[model samples]
Target: MNFDLTEERQMLQDTLRRYLRDKYTTSVRNEIIDSDTGLSDSIWAELAELGVLGALFTEEQGGFGGAGFDIAVVFEELGRAGVVEPVLDSVLMGGRLLAAAGKSDMVEEVIAGALHLAVAHGEPGGRYDLDHVHTQADGDTLTGRKAVVMNAEAADHLIVSARDGDAIGLYLVAQGAPGLTIQGYPLLAGGRAAEVTLDKTPATPLGLTLADYEAVNTLALVAISAEALGAMETATALTKDYLMTRKQFGRPIGTFQALAHRMSDLLIELEQVRSAVINAAGNLEAHDRDLHLSATKNLIGRAGRLVAEEAIQMHGGIAMTQEYELAHIAKRIIMADHRFGDTDYHLERFIALSAA
Candidate 1:
């Protein structure tokens, strides 16, 4: 099996990389992070126009690319830039769920960037379980609290998970609906998420099952694992550059034998992360997708922490400064581990699946 990117994917990667490099400078990203909404509307609109949003869906869902590689390619670029936009929330989670539920109209709007959506599935104590929905749907109304809903403030609609009888169901709740309240706050990395409170809010039931949610959640795992890989790459590169330029006692610190050896170790670990991401992306649609994704995420969680901590240690106090690029990059790398599942969580899941 050849590991090379196909012509189309290579072009996509190059185009996205160039665009982000030109437009998403560290200063500009800091401004976006400091803004009221914790995101840049102009940048989001431009990304939509560039077909970045469309790339996450299939042709049938009004996108040219929706394959696993497509998601990996796009998100990796986003992560490398340390972009704070909620593309993963809006497009991958919300839009893909909508598409799977036959909500073509909503999916088209999302692809066009006209409709911002968020998936409100996680609860206060749910951890990372997709089926641990305590939100109850009484007929067409839902009443429960959704914790840490990303992009909830900017969303036009929310895709909520609720318990309907003995099965878990998805419900669509319009933004500003009666009995809905959202308290927004900034995330540690960048961007904003909200604590959503629903008190018997009217919602439209979506025709989707728990299994569908699981599949999309797995896709999200693939996306963030790839994102972590890009972040690790950037962190490693930044650290390498710092070591080569920052002098210590009239010599470049990179020339120190100990530091050089540590950098070498980081590079080896980064390559391991890359391999895991590749395996996860390749097995996205396979029968054993869950097994592979669990392994990939577990590896990502451990390796990402190592890269972040090592990068910070290698760079010294300067790495923690808010103005410095590595500060945010390291945060992203560490936070990616917490998104889908942590190292311990995925390790147990991988072991369980292996036994099965």
Candidate 2:
């Protein structure tokens, strides 16, 4: 398969980059961080109007006949801009799961941007092993505790993975369901996450088969990995720019041989990670299940941490300051390591799979 960006994708990415750069400049992010609302609702509306919210779904589901690469383009731009939007959680979590489960009716509403949805997957334990879930779905009620649900409070709907009878399944829980309570919180990164507790909360079943569940979850992980790559790339560029302008002993600090070599090594790792992201994204529709996500997430975990640390080191004290973009970038990268699975987690899984 050819690894190339189509004309439409190029158009989509360039437009998003320009729009976000203007509207979500560093000032905007800083303001949002301090505001009563963690994010700008107006910006979210703009994204929906720009068709970005619906661009990853197919036309059959009321979308523009888009693809995963379409999502990759938008996410890359968002990462570069350090955007804090729930669009990723909306599409990657609820929208993809709906599509994977063949819920075309619900999928249409999501693609049309009428409903904001999130996946309440994480539990008391940090592990994302959905199949080993302890949450129970009893009739129309679900009882469980979910932590760090990305944009959970903002979601109109939530797709929760839980243990159903003898099988692991998904439950569609409305945000307004009785006995459901959500408390908003901030992630270590510059984004917001929520904790949701359900005590016999009313819910509908997604009825997705095991294959569909796995595919949707894996695709979400790969999507996050792509975003991580973008964050690292942006952080590295910012670091390099800072080094060139920052002077020591009446000369640009970047001229030092040791720092130059360190930047070079980090850049190489970034390129390798880019290749991994592209390969995994391209194979999102392919037959190989574990190989695609495992490779991408593992590479992202490694690259995200490595590049972020180097970027900080190059920026000196400024990098650690919360006011600096580098601080947010580094936080996002570190969170990515724990997002889908850290390097240690995915690497171990891959090794076990290889042995099997």
Candidate 3:
């Protein structure tokens, strides 16, 4: 399928790019990063005003009637601007999870820009296996722990993945639920994460079938792969700009054939990953999803790593400093590598799938 974006998609991308550049500043991101909330209310207000927070949902649910690609576009712009808000966890993951679970009552709250959402699915022991879950939910009560829960403090709701009578499922838990405790854990990329402990926390089952679970989880992975595209593009752009201005050997470094070729190779790899992302998103109901998603996630992880490393190299010592956002951008992608899924483990599964 052609990945050419439609006119609406183009418009949304352009609008978000402009908005991020104008409104979201390094200082603003720093403010949120330094605060307890780990979120900039003003920036979120701006996002809501720009319709970015609700850019990729249905009109009936107060969304902008956008697609996954549209959300990808917004993420790219945010990545370039070094947005600190948890757009992926709050809007994309949360919105999709709710919609998939047949929860429309929160749609207006979400779209009206009132509620932010997060997912607590990764356990401390690890979800790399994806099936060896240890969390438990019984009769509207849950008891478990999830780590690396992004934007947990800011989220109004959380979609907790847990096991119920030997069946892995999702639960929608109110942030204020009685037995739930959240402790902050910030990342190197200037965002607030947390370790969430649910001690018999109140929750409502998502009522998902086996097929639904598989599809939603795979789509979420693919969706995150799409977000990785954003960070990769920004890192590439930063590298390109750095090479353009920074002098080396008394000349613009980018003019050097060796560095130019390296940038070209990075660009090619990024394009290949982009193709893989598109293919993965399209192969939703294909016979072998584990293979498709694993390959896609692996490619995205590699592409993200390559772009970030090369960008840092091009930026020299300044890349690691707080002055430039490239370092933080790289860090976010690197950490994002472990979220939703891990590349090496998934690649092993992909190989196992292909072997059969």
Q: Which candidate gets the maximum lDDT versus the true structure?
A: 1
Runs in model 3 deviating more than 4 A are: 59-66, 209-213, 285-290
**Clashing residue pairs in candidate 2 (N, C-alpha, C atoms within 3 angstroms):** none
What's each prediction's TM-score? 0.98, 0.93, 0.90
Estimate, for each residue in 104-152, the C-alpha lDDT of model 2 and write its tens digit.
Answer: 8777777666677888877887586655567788887899898888878
Error of model 2, residue 351, in angstroms: 1.3
lDDT (10s digit) by residue, model 1, range 86-155: 9998889999999999999989888888899989989999898887888899998999999999999989
Query: What lDDT does each candidate get?
Result: 0.92, 0.79, 0.78
| lDDT for residue 168 in candidate 1, whole number 0-100 | 95
* Candidate 3 positional error at 346, Å: 2.4
Error of 2 at 215 (Å): 1.6
> Which residue pairs clash in candidate 1?
none
Q: Who is ahead in lDDT, 1 or 3?
A: 1
Q: Pairing residues by index, what is the TM-score of model 1?
A: 0.98
TM-score of 2: 0.93
| Clashing residue pair totals per candidate (backbone < 3 A) | 0, 0, 0
Q: Residues 155-266, candidate 3, lDDT per residue (tens digit)?
A: 8888888888878888888888999999987778777889999999989888863445455566567667776777788888888988989897899899999999999988
